[model samples]
Target: MSTPTGFMEYQRELPADRDPLERIKDWQEFHKHFSDEQLKTQGARCMDCGTPYCHTGIELAGSVSGCPVNNLIPEWNNLIYRGLWREALDRLHKTNNFPEFTGRVCPAPCEGSCTVGLIGDAVTIKTIEQAIIDRGFDEGWVVPQPPKVRTGKRVAVVGSGPAGMATAAQLNKAGHTVTVYERADRIGGLLTYGIPTMKLEKHVVQRRVDLMEAEGIEFVTNTEIGKDITANELVENFDAVVLCGGSTRARDVQMEGRDLNGVHMAMDYLNGTIKSYLDSNLEDGNYISAKDKNVIVIGGGDTGSDCVATALRHGCKSVTQFGTHAKAPLERDSINNPWPQFPNVYTLDYAHEEAKALFGEDPRAFSVLTKKFVGDGNGNLKELHTVQIERTVDETGRKIYSEIPGTEKVWPADLVFIAVGFEGPETPIIEQLGLAQDKRSNVKARYGKYVTSVDKVFAAGDMRRGQSLVVWAINEGREAAREVDKYLMGASMLP
Candidate 1:
């Protein structure tokens, strides 16, 4: 360890974000960075336990526990503590293909499993991680180093999200000709549209895409497999194929008056706003606007949070989010949620902070169930009806939600965005390839061995495992590339 008493000597600290009220006026990343000395002090807090759980990368209690990409947490922390940023950046890149993206947007399960968090706050792993990569970019340490030789093999990766990008990067490193197909007009699938600029700027994604392009990975946008090009043609044109199309098909709420004109899917709103913002700085009026409207977001996940933030930027009059589950506790429930498992705790995320700054309180309503959407006489959404619910366990151990009598209420809602989550991958590609599906309708490809029933065809990321973290998607992509390399050359050198 760099400092034996570092964990005890320092308390956890994070860089201050831009003032919430001020940042809401425009679309820019809000997070600030720490000074070099401050970062070194923060890095010294790593405990470097004999059994480091931070990089175990396992699922516990149905939630991710550590860095799913298995990033070498301790090594980089120590390097940063010793004032070796380039070395720390090198160590960080050993596992993750894109640290800048994850550092900005990842939930950082690594900190949750940190040994220091057992008694105190976890080390500032995420901050230090972002710092290392950002420094690398500024210092020109990160550059394209293409393979010197070609293997005379070709691979086609469908989808240009994190998973597809990682898969293409690794396979190209093995000297194979790689082509990535993105259905959207731009690369970076969900990264380009699903995420708003405040969290991750679009240029960060485009920068990586540029580096990958320079490394000889072909990216073909505005072309969708099974439509613009047949699946059979892709299979015939390439030596092998890997499907990284994420789980789309947003899960929707089935309720009365569902056909209102003001009701829309969360992705549609986010995608449109981001596209317009990038295209013309929101001057095009091509996206759904929440100005002077009462917006209600129906889900409590990250997507819902983004919707809330986006609405605030659009000068919405008021906003509220609904969740079916109870509010999380202030601290971890040791009995139900123990060490190493991700803690289900309550804290104000960025959007919540912004909303509180403007609205005087948090905007989430927990344990509330929506009963129906009440529309205006002309079929535009006007309000929503809901009832409070309580949880109970039956004799058979099944969970049930019982509606409380006298708790029915109605709230004005000019626009409603459903962010309930996704069901699975879209059907067109799956059906065209005649791929087998699991019970969840995800592609039936085993975890480590990403082989499908069809020969020379593989699957990874959300399409294979359903909606999950981007870090896990990177993990699957890297492993799938290894397997594909083995299949092609009768052996593999990828890790």
Candidate 2:
């Protein structure tokens, strides 16, 4: 620990967000940073317990409890508190390959399992992490370190998401020539298109890609494997192949009148928005427009929240989000739900806060289902038919729902966004490669081993485990690289 009286003397604090109303005007990030001294004081709040669950990185109660990448939380916290920022960044890079990405967008499971959180508030672990990495970049300490030796082994990593990037970076460090192939116009996969710009900037993603490229990892964007480059060609040419193609199949809602012009997948809308932002300032008119229209987003996950924020920036007249399940509890029930696991409770995100400030109410409705979408004669979406639902626990302890009688209602909506969830990775590559698949349609691969049925062909991240957090993807990436290295050279020096 940095100080003997740290936890007792100081309280937990985080950087304040910019005013919601002003922030909603543009797509810039909302956080107003704190001074280095304030961040050090915040870092001092860490208890640094003997078994610090903050970095356990495991699922305790059906949800993530701590850092999945297993970031050295307490060690870095103490380092920051002691004013050893460069050293703190070094420790951070030991586990997570990309602190900048996690610091900006990760949900920060570390705070949920913080020992200090057992009673009082948790340490500002996420803020401290962001501060440390951002400072490293600002001070010009972070640089490209290419491996001095070459093993003459060439590896091909398909899908340049978190997993592929991590695997490629690690393999290259182990003196292997690694090449990452991306299908999109730019690298970073969802980091480039799927995510809204306000949350994670595109340049940040490009900067990391550029750094990795400088470190001798070849990034071939717009050159998709199994399409432009054949899968068999890769397997025949490279020493080994790793499939990190993320889960891209969006879970859709099937209802009456599902086909409509204004209705779109959340990723479709988000991807188009980012592409338009990057291609030009929406000048091409190729993107979906919610301007001066009522927008209704289905599903209440982070993607749904992102849709709400994106619509708000597009000058939507009104926005509302729907969830099939009932509202979550305001406070965690300590008796039934204990600590060391992420709490299941109500929390307002950035978009919801802005919606409340602008619309005079929270734009979320729970225990409701959209029965059908009513459209105009021109195939344009116009209204939504919905009904309230009641939730009850089944004998097997599952929360099931049924429509409530005499509670049907109709609401006007000009645009509809489906943000339900994802099913699994797309099947073209898996099918072409003849890789075995799980019942859930995910690529069949062992967790630690990450080897597919086909020899020398491995998989990781969403491709192997289905849709998950970025931190989890990075973890899968590193672990997968270790396994791949061992397969390649009969041993691996990677963690």
Give me the candidate number with maximum TM-score.
Answer: 1
Predicted candidate 2 versus true structure: per-residue lDDT over 1-495, tens digit per residue:
877678889877778999999998888889889998998898888877899999999988688998999999999999988899899999999999899899988999888889888888889988888888889989999899999999888999999998999999999999999999998989998778787888898888888998999999999888888889888888989989999999999999898778987889999888888898889877887788889999999998999999999999889999999999778898877976689879778989999999999998899999889999988988989899999999889999998889999999998999999999999998878878898999999999999999999888999999999999989999999999999889989999999
**What is residue 406's positional error in candidate 2, in angstroms?**
2.1
Which 10 consecutive positions of candidate 2 have the poorest summed lDDT? 332-341
* Candidate 2 backbone collisions, by pair: none
Question: Would you estimate the TM-scores of all the predictions?
Answer: 0.99, 0.98
Off by over 4 Å in 1: none
Against the reference, the lDDT scores of all candidates come to 0.94, 0.90
Q: What is the lDDT of residue 314 in candidate 1?
A: 99
lDDT of 1 by residue, 1-495 (tens): 879999999989999999999999999999999999999899889878899999999999899998999999999989988999899998999999999999999999999999898888988989999999999999999999899999999999999999999999999999999999999989998888898999999999999999999999999999989899998899999999999999989999888988999999999999999999988999999999999999999999999999999999999999999999899999999899988898899989899999999999999999999999998899899999999999999999899999999999999999999999999999888898899999999999999999998988999999999999889989999999999999999999999
Q: Where does candidate 1 clash, by residue pair?
A: none
- Candidate 1: worst 10 consecutive residues by lDDT? 188-197
What does candidate 1 score on TM?
Answer: 0.99
